[model samples]
Target: MNSRQGALLRALLNAGDYKTAGEYGRELGCSDRTVRSDVKALNAALAREGFHSHVDRQRGAGLRIVVVPDEENRLVRLLGEAEAEMHPRYERLCQEMLALTCHPGPHTADLLARRMFRNKQQIQADLHWWQGVLELSGLSLSLGRYLKVEGPEWTIRGFVMSMLFSFPAPAVRRRILPSLVGSLDPYDRQFLERCIAEMQRDLGFEFSSNAQWQFGVYLCIMVTRIRLGHSLAAWRDAREPGPFFAYLQKRLERHFSMTVSDAEMGLLRDMANCCTWQWSLAAMEAYEPTERARALADAIASALADAFGAPVPDDMRKPLAILLESGLARRGCGLVAPNPNEEAVKYEAMDGACLLSSVLAEVPALVEADLFSPDYARLLLVLFDYLEQVGALRCYRVGLVVNCGIDLALWGAHRIEKLSSRLQVTDVLTENEVAAAAARPGSALAERFDFLVSFEPLDVKFPSVTISPAVSRADIDHIIASVPLWRRGREVRTAWEQEVLPVGPSPEGLFAALHGRLVDEGLVDMPRERFEWLLWTLSIVKDRTLVLAWCGPGVRRTGIRIFRLEEGDGAECGRCTMAAVLVVAPADRGDLTPLTQGFKRLVEDYADTSGAVNDDGFFVCFPDPE
Candidate 1:
């Protein structure tokens, strides 16, 4: 089946209800006639294949699939296999990347084209894609005569691991990684898988499915690389041996006839920590959060709760805190994992992400952390979005009204509570009350609630939805859809822009210019010497192209300025190209950590890499009105 046909089939199966062809066409980006044609073809194929399912079209209600309950699983499985067969790009990319990394070569585009059965143009496109991927890790792919990835050994290894385990689905990774590794024999791959399973059993805890796959893939790559004489001997470490060092050391030597050094064992230990909770009680004891991590996590959780105007439950708070702790450690090591869902999250939750960045910037403890990267925000965004789905961040305070008897109005209130845990019926309003609220848009009745829902038509200045007194399915769906519109109106704030400044020779000089602006605008009255000292002491250089500095307490505003680092201008400030400078004021608790982190997030969103800034300047944010 083609991708569109497969998508149509999956949608019908997932919905399990009738939907008009027009709806499917709009959702799948096709015409109504095309959707109907695909459905007809898909049904014939399903019947021919002996699947006990067929898409049945209804006159007005639209089309839905009729599936035998027992055959549903098999039908879904077949559909998935067909979809995988249709899209082989991800698998090919994995194979091409592994090929370049494993063999030493000026692996030319011509050679890759022949090996992968693609034209040179296709191979070049692949190379371009790889360039973007490597750039995320601050690495580069040399495209001269042959293709080769160039970077520090540790970074290259991390990149490989990230790529291999990036696809979170266990079944997909298991099917892809082993077959892509050209050097690993079937017996050896199985041995490594068995070894990972044994380790998990011995540790008295099962690795999460994704972790199990990650562990197996990591060992396979490491062993294959080692056999190829690419040992990480130069990657030195003097730390004590890990708890699993002895155990893993014996297994590798016994099975592969190779012994591992302390550095290799240390690497294994770190990987294990990331893949599982702990190996033993001692490890758990040693894994206690540092005081800084705990404080920052608490502050983040509290800020998130405040922004949503809801109390985060202990279950939600605990995971968020743990993520912050690990995120802080990962940032310290300069290891940022790619957020597979970054673009999707950014598109779907733009308002939440912006508000979250603002809240994080105000966090007092976040100043000491380097955890303000896009990957980190994406992770938090995914979590926050998930929490909203599960009703943990449910803050839709709704007002209820009915033209029926008081008893029915009370019943409608309870029905709304059952319709979705997200809606809270804060008040049951009378006709007179509704009229009063309509007259005064800023009345307590209007201000105290988010939206009004009534069984009958009621004129009110507040956002209102009309629903059945019994809350029908259509009404529930309408309420569900309206929530986001209300949320957007409440959460999205207007961001003000400031003037960009020219790149100064040094951060000290930049601060002098900014100090002059703040002084003239009546924003700050600090002496130049003190501002210079803060710039020197409280600044962070990132990607050799961006700098963030704290403009100590009592400043009236927080802003970001893009400084033009013309040609070699950045060298003086330890930057290589056009750089961004963030000047932040202290948060309420007397620390600039929150604002610094927040500004980093803003920079990530607005910094133009595609030559969008022609004036040698990029200024994006303004001071908080408060």
Candidate 2:
């Protein structure tokens, strides 16, 4: 079934009750007669396949899908396979290319086009795009009399494994894996899942559900790629392949009859290396990082300090080294790779992308090199937890000014006071006399506190968060998470007030520019909500080397996105360039309006402890509404 059929089938299956003909038609965006016709075709297809389900219809009730009692799994798999094959253009092309990679062989252009259900021109266009897709995995796609994927043997294997690792888990909300390399050996898949559970227990590091899927698919693919003769050969048993590679090669050599290359063997060992990493800090460091990787780690630490004014503690250097080394294998071999936790880290962990992206900005040349990935963000989070645990991450001093309009509001202020020790409450002033509080502003009280909390909104020159006196446990927990990040909005307001000439790009232009940057920099594609994209776009704010804000259509119309560029070593007030690109990472385009409040909140969080700017200032910006 194609997308239409898949959409229709999914709608029907997801419904708990019968649907009307008009309802089904509306849901599928078709005429009732058309849906009925499609239903007939669907029923025919199901009957032809000997499936135990058919669309049953009642005059008023639209349609109901009845599944056989024990045929649920079978029907689901059938529908999944059918849905995977229905593609429109690029996706279909990608699918065909993947199929070619899986079993590269002789086929004339006419024959290939016929097999792909496309014309010759479409096939050629697909081939063109396929070339670009291959480059991401360090492979080259070439079509001759026979289809062949040409690349260094190691890279070819890497390309395949990376693709395999990217396969969507069966349990994904949408199972979008194309036909090629989509199916898994049931027994092998089970074994790998069990292995992930065992590894998590052994290592004492929890794996998110997604992480387990990543590792399982990666390990399973390694085995499948080997048995299929897509492996490496050992030129020498000694250090040529490295000891880890040699050891893994011996383990797998008996399992596979084909020759395994040193690269392939090395890739397999990296699977363990990644596991060691996810397992525990000490276990990960046991596999020493290469000097180059260690040096890169040092440079990373130094650059973060240089760029963000935050120093990476020296004690955490070893873990950074291990992470860098594992990153090398993941990137180099393109085998089992970790799903980046950038989403959790970006807004959650204090814009974690800053550390890595800053490193890229320092050495612009490394933008396309090994430095940028969601994986980099994950590494930073691990570092952040350790630093916080050791009390290296700085905390802000806060004060509370409670003036209760009601008893509940007063209680909330007390709750804020009773928060964890991370926040050292400098003072708490209970303003029982409203006339006195109104007569005398809390500006001085607000100034004394790094963070200001109040039951009643105070007319203080610093930002004061007015909370209900009766806060819930969850609200308190949220406050705890945010306490360390509490910045007086005044600081961000000041940083933003003194602004540079802003760049505005139309949504289209913004995406195009970002997409261009990704390709030019040889960087992997980012998620749709890419914070790195935001950082890259905002390059106008700081010294990431943009001549001027690439002002497009929106910045003038959209709310301003601001960031602080703290003075670093060799960094002084003499410099003229001042800006940060405020675009989202990786994916090119989306409306920036939704991010306005979030942008203000994050900037405030970043500048929470900056003692500049008046405490009563608002931390928001408004665009010139057209």
Candidate 3:
């Protein structure tokens, strides 16, 4: 149909019940004579479709479509036509409808319908059809019919706004349909849209509907999690590759082929860097210099390229690079040092490099003083160097510093001055104290003096292991069955046995056996401090399955507890005397079946504690130790 005819139909649909020729003419910016002719044409058009329209009027009354067509059929046909048209503007219309349905009020539907070639009845029918389609596609559409109709209103206006901004194409629609359909209401969408818009405006980018939707979905989920007081960062970290990100990646790879240039790669890397930096800053409120930031940037770039299969334009690279370099420099480090004379060039390079150094500093600081090892320090240095090469160092700086109470001058006589400065060591050790400690055999300060850095304490401790309360003996059995060593004659038990059972079977044997099982199953590492902390926690929780005990009248009753490894040393659990309670002795033959059977029972009963119980007790179970 011609645009004029469509416009006329839209006006009619928006007018609702009826309108006199004069009123219709006034609304459409046309004359009464023209309105009357348009009405005649509208009737003729309906007649051709096996439907007829009749206008009726009484004295001092208005004109109305007396015979409304079969609205469902007409709406279905119109939607089909709209779909076939593939007009970009149709997306806007859909968004408006979505918005209207969410907060349906008197003239809201009418206003929306006015944009389409359909009457109010047809508009309502179309809404019903769209809602059904969304449901079929795993979405939900809620109508706001409770409010008065005096003005515009809708139930899910926010959602409509978000959808309009987020779902820009059929492909994006398909990707997000599953997650967003039932989860979002109109209001939620609208609110999310506003958030995304604000974020985009702040970032100085005009995001597409697909981009907006993806971000909105993330924001929505995160906001919900935060509102419920859930672990937001942990949840985000745990989320796997969902359909939206997967699909987007696929599309991006398809667009960018294998022969992508350095410039293109750099651009993609920069964009990813910006996004990662923004997200990290928003979530962490802190920045670090290291391969982690670069890796994140690379991941985003690689995913985008792999999905689109097209090289990014050279034009896009410069701006992104500038942003990455600037952000990194402000944070602390960059790959290349910018020229001093060139304000723009130097700032770009130095920013990334500085950011990197800052971030690298944090790794050592997070390490516990007693548990600090040369290996950890080495790992941090390696990570720092890697970050420098990839240009991720520009994102932020690490603020961690070693706090030695005294200056390095006190150790001058020992020629350890360089060691002190090289390690960022603060001389908490006085000159006389160091000399006196050096004379002692195996002094308390000697062993742990190498790594004495400390981190800011957090209210909640980080989770060392992920355990499920739902874990049962069956799960443990499955794990046990997979161990080759557990199978007779499969492998010889030797010095390695000490790795699992440091003191051998009695109580020590049990502890080692459980420790080996956990490590074999990839539930923990071989760090002694980590093991001690976990053991302490397990002791506090008193998991009958994890604790093995032998008690008799005169014999030293021994208890062996199993625990996961943590980051710090035994210092955290120094108050717990579970280690002292362990008994080491020759392998005894007393009631082995009872010990095994009791453990099995405990494993079966191990249920992860929920809510407040989680804070006070160890509710998680390691995978089955077969």
Candidate 4:
């Protein structure tokens, strides 16, 4: 069960059928004598388990576990022995060697190299070693060369089990158990139990594996989060007395025969309450109104007390009252009124609204317009309803531009703005600069106007219009000039329109306009040759706008065509055209094919159909016109 023996067995397993002692020695980075000794030790261990190891001298020479005993049991016994006998540091080293390489950013490789004082070659070797180990366990490790680590089922299970044993104390185990088991599914649990059972039966060692402890911690965190809002008060007042927590506790005790102490339960309740209050307050401050926040706080507190095993903290009750008063004082609910003129305030509000809308929109069953309310509690209820509709909320921490004036803008935005500013000074303007200047009139020195506007209608909607090719800069300037007011006007008009009209529901009518002007003798017939070429060229033009007028958001039209032109010599000249049209919609659309796959499939289908065209002397292959 030593490292050397395990290494030999791994080599044999990897080699499949069999391997010579010399081959095994070379792979293990050891001498032939060492390999022989390792084989002998492994065979002895196998013999003890009522399995025989045989080396066929005449059959091309390689040791094999002739009586392939239950592999699951063998692995378990090996793991138990390794755990019992291996030095802590040696065990750590083994784990490290078996660790999957995480896709670290460009800087990560260098950072890890520097920290470990190991070269890139060594790191790569370790990655290979881990991959080999995982292969033995019917698992795979995928590390994005520059991003993240994704371990397969068995590998992940093994890592979790290792982590469980690695903890020195029960408190540490309790703290980490949730993180360890939270990501596992039923299959993972079964695999883990198999590994544990194998170890117990073969090695005569009991694994201190507690499914209840693992599940309890997971349920506790979620239950606490549910009863508490993502605010300061929610975090503070989060207690374990919510019905969900109580139910979870009962389930755990019934299933595992383990009892949770009153003291531990109290502490857990307090922690949940505190977390709940804190998050609730933060969420309220960010999005909800005073009255709504107060109501939400009450609802969450009551929910927590009724379901979980603990009551809301007394301090949280006082703060909730104070928050309500403060909210009312600031606005009607002690919340400050939104300031559109202030860059920070305007951007924050817009960003928050966009985020909230996106989160709610993901839930197909929830009506986003109906969810907006002045009351905090009602808003929270709506948010929860949306989350429930969506089945789950994946919480991710992302950096927000608290002060964009100070923060470096994203590359595309910065580049566009920089080019526009340079174009204002230069005589020769770039295409990008011209586009930017058209979007925002005047030089960058001029006061920037807020483009966002809110309207009081049955449903919240943003005014949007597609730019027509015919619209001139002067025409746009005249429209801007006509509208004296910059804020929400009584009329719905673009920066280019003349007379503003009251904003109405989104228009469903489609308007078609020609881009080019007609001559005095209008509508002249185009030459057949020119028209034919133009139509032929259209096959190559993958622009979605030209192909389909009403493509859904984020959807693009792409296809392939094969054109066969027969010459007088009875020979055919063919051209294969693969076209891809990229369409980015003005708003988010739920269903859209990825651009790459869409193009690839279009080309593949076109090629397949084109190859089977009729033997008519002249042939043109195209997709179904409709």
Each candidate: RMSD: 10.6, 14.1, 31.7, 30.1
Whose lDDT is greatest here?
A: 1
Sorted on lDDT, best first, the list reads 1, 2, 3, 4
What local distance difference test score does each model get?
0.59, 0.49, 0.34, 0.32
What lDDT score goes with residue 314 in model 2? 72
Off by over 4 Å in 1: 6-19, 41-56, 63-84, 103-110, 144-146, 166-175, 234-238, 277-318, 325-356, 362-397, 403-411, 418-422, 429-450, 456-462, 468-477, 480-626
Model 1: per-residue Cα lDDT over 1-626, one tens digit each:
77678777877887887899988876666789999999889988998999877899999899999998898888876764554334456556766788787654558998888877888888798788677557756789999876778876556766666555444344244445555455667787788887888776666667766567666666776776666566666434456765666777878878888756666766665555455521243433334554655676677767767755665565444445545665654443334444434433432343334344445555666645645344355345535654565443345788887667878987888888887666898888877787876687456764667778887777655677788776866687677555533431242221234455544544445567766765776555677875554443233333233444444354666555555443243233322233455444434322222333444455554443321111101011111111
**Per-residue lDDT of model 4, residues 359-434, tens digit only:** 3223322321122112222233233333323322221111111112322224323332343221111122223433
The residue pairs in collision within model 1 are: 106-146, 107-147, 361-594, 361-595, 367-593
Candidate 3 residue 243 C-alpha distance from true site, Å:
11
TM-score of 3: 0.19
Please give the distance, in angstroms, between residue 379's alpha carbon in candidate 4 and its true position after superposition. 32
Prediction 4 TM-score vs. true: 0.23
Tens digit of per-residue lDDT, candidate 3, span 318-362: 333333333442222111111112211111122222222223222
Positional deviation of residue 505's Cα in model 2 after best superposition, in angstroms = 15
Which parts of model 3 have CA positions greater than 4 angstroms off? 50-60, 66-73, 76-256, 259-626
